[model samples]
Target: MKKTITIPLGSQHISLLEPVRFNFSCENEKITDVDYNVGFVHRGIEKACTEKFEYKQVGYVVARVCGLCAITHTMAYTLGIEHILNIKTNKKIDYLRILMLELDRIHSHLLCLAHTAENSGFEGMFMKIMGDRELVMDIQEAISGNRVQFDFVCIGGVNRDISTECEKLAFTNLALLDKKVDDLIGKFTSNWSTALKYKNIGALSYDDAFNFNALGPLARAAGAAIDVRAESSILPYKEVGYKMILGQNGDIYDRNLVRLKEIKNSILMCQNILSGLTEGEILVKFKGKPNGESFTRLEAPRGEIFYYLNANGTNMLQRVRIKTPTFSQIPGMVEIFKGSDYADAPAILASFDPCMSCTAK
Candidate 1:
């Protein structure tokens, strides 16, 4: 006779920062079925953007959608509005926008790597990554005046300009971060224990990734070769030397490697932006109300984040819609949980870097 058991990894857990629940049906340590819920932290930000806030204020409101990727959300919303308003921002504004966006990506990817390490019983690696992540955070604060919700991007242009001090600070810190991240890549790839916890675990094949329409590192790690930065022209990602990083095996290890490589790529992009800094006004005054519908897409740290806006040539918008990456990847995530050991669930979940706040919003 065979025995089967069920395990639930919570709507709240020490390993998770946000509210999400997963139930695993296991037979002799291998998972046979999986279920998940991502609605614990829904705050109705979409409704509030249309009902309560004006077009000018909705950018800031959407920035609160997820602190880690706040800059991405703000940039997406601002791009949609700029498209509707037909604002031709200068090159300097675009450069500065890409700088902040890359900085945000660096820090967000580090946090995800740290969380994955901690879940894999690598507390020391987690501490090292977190400590080094502060370098990027400091640069963010210096540039945008805040760590998480910078509110840097606006409808016409950026809210602030890069000063000489900020430029030097960014260059110096990125040099330091480059070295630390290289060390992390070494540890994640060469260390046997880390490889054991991560390699060949929670794998999603190329077929599965395509079938599920997965995005971000999850899809890239599976060799899906789909990246919004490469596909979408909404941002000047190509001007900043954007390259899509892909992996052959879709497992936790590959996911970590993809993120590490992306961090290096983001650092290079920031350096490129700073080196080619042109002179222009960071903010421009526009005198018309947004009167049409617009949509914009950008590559957030986790995946593609999209914003849709409908305006009626008034101060207030008629509708605001957000399609976050985590929400779209839930089906893929559930599929990965199947056929894996129940004990490996936490590490697998961490590798996906699921953001419940972004999903439920």
Candidate 2:
């Protein structure tokens, strides 16, 4: 008897934890052609903001677009709103905004690390990484009253500010986290088997990536210098120092490395920001509504996030659109998975850190 087996992983897969499709042609150990079909469920978040909600309401709406990227989404929407209004908040508002965003990165990176660890069958490491990340999440909640959806930002400025005591608490926590991150990174990168497992095993070469027009870690993993944070700061980000991390191999390993290093650098930036905290107002009052079109670009944890809004001097926005990082990364994912082995596909796919909701929205 002869049997032909064709295993298609998705438009839905268990590892993905989201609705997305992968059509994999596997002949024994090798994957022949990998075709990805994303865009499974696109929630109409833009309409929810522009049509249903008021200008002020859009911040929280956008923030909730991706739970992992809540603050980043919130910031992107707020920055867009601010652009339309041409409003600027005070100094303390800037520091708090940057601080919350960086903390979100730490949390997001930690979750990625944990998930990657679990995917690689290192459950112990996963548990420990997740454990270490809990404090950061707690710190996030302590600062903003919610771990994932902080709702920290409003149109004019932030909703809360860190006091001297809060600063002292954060200082203690970040100092400890810095040391742990160094140790975890040392273990992740320095181990021979681990290094080899990532370094070139899931290699994503150049041509395949560009065709997809991928941005963020997915593109950066392919050796693209496409970081939005390097030279541009959307708000008062110029005052807060950030180093853009890049990888040349464009493999799972390089992405893991970039995320790890970026997390460490974000921790350092938090320390630097906390040391310079001064007394000021958390937010400003924007009594007048906005008019005309406005666009905003922010360096989110995933990559550059763009928001566009058209206002008509009304309570609600005339139009709104957000181009999330995940949307840009999908095409690149399809390209890299083309010829990889079936076993290696999951890790390869996860390296991009796709957020389907963000993409669909």
Candidate 3:
């Protein structure tokens, strides 16, 4: 006997957790096909980038694309506009941008990790991850003065310098984080129930992972080793040096492992940037409008974020579009979830830690 059911999952989408809907065709409690629908939270961000608002003002507007990725959005926009303006930023500016970017990574990843734990029904571990997350948030608050919406990026460079006080507090949090992460590593591995639950669940082979076009920790956990930080040297990333984090098995456990390993790298990157502070102007003056098209990409905590812009030498003349990694990888969810039992759906979905606003924005 065979049983088939269609579970239309969500306006508060479950697959990638981004407010999209998916028509899931399941048979005998196993999903078969997942048809996706976005545009649920379309704020008309790209549409709003038209005229009326100056290029500089648009930076703040676009930064609101996703609170978690505010800095990355701003950086990408600023870079594209500068490229069109033919402005070359200095070395110090590049380093500062990267520092801010890494700080965002720490905050975003920690929050998502906490959520993932909650989804897995691990209440104790969930709280622990969130408790450690406060350290990163504190550091972010100290740096840009606002943890979530760091409106500190301007057109040419960052709006503020790395103060000594800021550096000290950030370092303190990093040290505290070191201790907490060590504790978490022990718990995640030793919690036999959790280990068994996540070990081989939602498995993906490297071939399937590549075909799905996964990015960031998700791709790395599957042993792809494809990181925009390494592939694209947009900032002063080449200076401090970083190794791509990867895992042998592409499963829920591997994703968790990759993210945990990345947290340490992010902390070290932040500390190194603060210690090697260089003296240079944070903001630079530029005149006129952009005249061409340009694209920028960054390794967001979830995955790769892509921004494409075209300018026409006017205050409000251009095109803007962004491709979020979650949206790109949504199809892959269908592939992995097809044979998975209904009970495991939510946990597997959360394992990707998908951010829907970011996806649809």
Pick the lDDT winner: 1
Task: List TM-scores for all candidates, in order.
Answer: 0.97, 0.93, 0.95
Query: Which ten residues in a row are the worst by lDDT in model 2?
Result: 1-10
Local lDDT at 238 for model 1? 95
Residue 268 displacement (Å), model 3? 1.0
For each candidate in turn, give its C-alpha RMSD to the true structure in angstroms: 1.3, 2.3, 1.9
Query: Model 1 residue 245 lDDT?
Result: 96
What's model 1's TM-score? 0.97
User: Which model, 1 or 2, shows the larger lDDT?
Assistant: 1
lDDT of 1 at 182: 88
What C-alpha lDDT do the candidate models reach, one value each? 0.90, 0.78, 0.79
Question: Judged by lDDT relative to the true structure, which candidate is superior, 2 or 3?
Answer: 3
Candidate ranking (TM-score, best to worst): 1, 3, 2
lDDT by residue (tens digit), candidate 1, 276-346: 89887888788899999997889999999988889999999998999999988988988998888888888
Which tens-of-lDDT digit does each residue in 1-361 have in candidate 2?
3242467776656678577777776677777666666678778888888778888888888877888888988888787778778787777787888898889888888888777777787778889999999878878878887767788888788877776677777888888888898898787787653455777766666676667676766667677777766756665655677776767878877788878888888888889889988887777887788888977777777888988889999999888888888777766666666566788877776667777778886
In angstroms, the error of model 3 at 136 is: 1.2
Q: How many clashes (backbone atoms < 3 Å, residues ≥3 apart in a chain or on different chains) does model 2 have?
A: 6
